[model samples]
Target: MATDSLPSAFTLFESIQPGPVYRIPSLLYLNSHQVFLAFAEKRTSSSDVDAKILVLRRGKFQDGSVEWDETVELSTAVKSGYRSMNPCPVYERLKQVVYLFFNCVEDGVNECSQVLWGRNAARLCYVTSQDAGLTWGQVTDLTESVIGEQVQHWGTFSVSPGHGIQRACGTLIVPAYAYIIRYRCCLIPPGFFTKPRTFYLYSEDGGERWSVGEPLSRCGTGESEMAEIAVSYGNRVLYCNARAVAGPLSCRRPSRVEAVSLEPGRFEIVHPARQLPESDSGCQGSVLSFSCPASDQFSWLLYTHPVGSGKDRWWRHCRNRTNLAVYLNRRPLEQRHWEGPWVVQSGPSGYSDLAYLDQASTFACLHECGDRQPNERIDFRLFSIDDVLRNIEQRGRGVATSLKHRQ
Candidate 1:
């Protein structure tokens, strides 16, 4: 079937604010028919920046519409003195709790870069909401528990942590990188570059406290950003990451996504692995969630920007265009190949978050779009799986009939 003919896009939701909003993250819960959008609102004053979490509930109306309502605010001035970004929340079915986790920064600087230096105390914290997202309990420090005895040097190790959801066993795994500073020629002080080890932490008691796990993988890659980790049917844990390229000023690297087995305190990489298309630039892909209806069966959906081979390769420069792709398998934890990267929506120049709702019948994405470019206003778009499947089927039939006639 022609890839372009497939239903490549859907209208999940739209921008809510007049200005541009960025760093938006979304979570969808199928059992409860609920969707949550969390992001940081940028203000002219750094202190005015606040982290906002919005809840959208699927209504019973026949029109196939959803209603969004603001539930709680984790404002910098109100809740915590630091600015919150990268909000990641996971729902615990057994405990009936939703744990909302976010990255907190004191000065509101992008920790990914080394220009701005701060304390190593930056963290990924959480707050729980029992009744969906209507109300939130007191904020809890999940970072402290994650980084138990890990020493922070020059306030770099504790910055820019990544997290994932292990839905099968209801475990929330957070991965953090250890960083070291090196002095640049012109730059006043040295910048922070990720070290070799990757640390993981999990919450078995519903985000109240996290137990630290040993490093999963180690490599010569300057900085390895943890994206997603899932337990496959074979009882192996897959770890995905974006590796940093070697160079003084080069931020590009061969994007490496690997899978590993989950042992007591460590893991090993899986072979016959799934890899990105050659078109992808060295940018790392973010795994949204692993959905499995039956035991030991699942699919891992990831979002990444497409790029070509070379240093200046820009594939379809839809600036900051976010692409959706998936890898499915029926076997146990054995390695498999990735299928999609079915493009959903692009136009805005920023990161987009996706969630599956209503038993995967509905898919929603929340991202930044506006006149301000990159970080502007936050908007959401929803699409029905049924509609997408119908389109795919129609496209498939067209391909089949054409092939038969040609023969």
Candidate 2:
């Protein structure tokens, strides 16, 4: 952890004193408009099944500060008798269209029941905005057209709860996951005979046509996000980081799962990321890649998640969701080279999404964090690349000094 404290967080969404609560934050930055669109699930309570509406707040960056507008409900983004959740926004640069993708789950139905029973009650949907979120078009349901019969086999599925990516070649990629039913147990509290795997939805001709990619070969990975970065001169690949779901099928240690796609849809390599720790039962984190400050030919990856504080092996249990940290990987292809959990928030924190402002050389993190519990509020923080590098260097020296004393 960094010795220096981070700047105070700017609260964007909070739980209304007693009633309605907000959760599942997704952040999108439009380079051309110089605007940011922050999305969240407006629920009657903190429970996932209570999600009722999809809400958004627009923030315009100017004069070194973000001026956010009042929250607006995307009425068209929902379906009758269903709850909207997991707000994922993707921008089509050529069309100047921003597509907000989310899942509409059947009302009163929770994920556990759906998975255990092998019944899917969620729909894949999205709405678009042409004028930088000033207005949105009608909701488009693609569950039948794209997913088709395949969805029936899925116990339940969802799109990335954060921002999606657009490759340099004009391909749009949305990270997603599904719990495929393996069997059914007739006993009470029926066994969850299912396997969770990460996959993606992609579009080649802007947002005109979409296709589902093959699910990752590895199991027990879910709620993922992707970033397209240059690995070499004129060469780029898609980097993915996902929540490591704990189960009999998962890895022995709790850690984030990572993979890379040589092209657009298929993940060529999958492995457990030992360097990044995942909260027990897993929590959705965010990853963003940006050009190295020293050279545009190379890129670096930034990740944000809650870092366990206690020395006990079981420290990542629910109540201990504290010390939100941002890690950097200079060599994106090498999972072992990750560095610096820069401890941005030293208290309870949860889901996070990252965005880079090229003009400012700054990174913005829209995250779930609070003084007592992580779900109490969603806050934002802006820090520079230099800030991360300096803190990481300090942490490296501290570790080296400790090693010398032990020897």
Candidate 3:
């Protein structure tokens, strides 16, 4: 199928001239309510320090179309002198409550300063809504109670900028990462070296209490999302896909890092997924697990991100944050079995969040894409599994024909 022939995308949030830009999309779909909640950071400009507040829009899905309501600022989900960022929403099934998790950073403090000085300024917090986002409760600060003294040992930390997942076993998993200080030198100005690693904030009992799981052993991993996948014979495992923050001297190249955890507090890091490429300097992506469209007993994985090769080797002019694509994998545990990067958006694109609409066998992507800059506006697109399969098959055949001519 041709990219232009697909359904047209809807603009959920657009940036105006002299103010209030939108970025960092977080999308969640509630099956019971047949509704979609889209969240994003409303910033004064494109810079991170200019982030002001969180905004939300509720969409009602029916008859193959969505009616999105007006966008509203989450005024109550903020602190006195802090800016809210990284909206991570997870639904609790039994109570049918939605927990909107985000990081509240001090007004002027940026993440680079936090990593250098080994001082943490970001606070882990959330708010709850019983009516699927009609109204929200007061903000609940979880940094002090959950992170505790450990906050001093590291730099900055934050939750997933997208939606979290609730396992079939009733465990709520919120993907997160922290910059841990590895070396400190006592001098005129305190010096510290830190590296990013991924972990989870989980609640086993209906969102009453939460605990921090152990960080992944590998370094240079950050800004992640999680999904619960059922391996062979109905054994559930947690799968994480994170942004790889590779440095000049680092051994690993820039790519999306994958890991699996059988239980909480322990993660087995898999090799970087070569098939699913990352943009240069790394960009956040989303992963979602759903039952195969054909089979009920097994699950498949769908990941959405930019299609750049994570370097200047391939596309010289546009090396990063371009060509938003979605890759499909039938074998969730394997690293090299990914197929079909069905290009959802062919131009400038940035961070994206994916949600499965089971009623129509479609996947929805809320992403940042624009003509010049990737973060200029936020848009949403819907495509079915059949669409992806058809595109992948065509691309494979074209590649084979090209190789044959070269031989």
With candidate 1 superimposed using the best TM-score fit, by how many Å does residue 67's alpha carbon deviate from the native? 1.9
Give Cα distance to truth, residue 79, candidate 1, Å.
5.2
For model 2, residues 1-407, the per-residue Cα lDDT tens digits are 34465856789999976887889999999999999999998988889989999999999998768999999999899899999999999999999999899999999999988887788999999999999998999999999999999987788999979999899999999889999766666774222568889999999999999999988888889999999889889999998898886664543557899998886679999998999877668889999999998899989999988886745365336457777888999999976999977888877788999999988888899999878888889998888888899988888788799999999
Q: Candidate 1 or 3, higher TM-score? A: 3
TM-score against native, each model: 0.68, 0.96, 0.95
What lDDT does candidate 1 reach at residue 363? 59
Tens digits of lDDT, candidate 3, 295-316: 7677899998887533345334
TM-score ranking, best first: 2, 3, 1
Question: lDDT of all the models against the reference?
Answer: 0.45, 0.88, 0.87
Model 1, position 231: C-alpha lDDT score:
52
When summed lDDT is taken over every stretch of 10 residues in candidate 1, the lowest stretch is 1-10
Which candidate tops lDDT? 2
Give the backbone clash total of model 2. 0
* Candidate 2: 10-residue stretch with minimal lDDT: 310-319
Candidate 1, residues 257-291, lDDT tens digits: the string is 45453553455662323344322223333444445
| Model 3 poorest 10 in a row by lDDT | 309-318
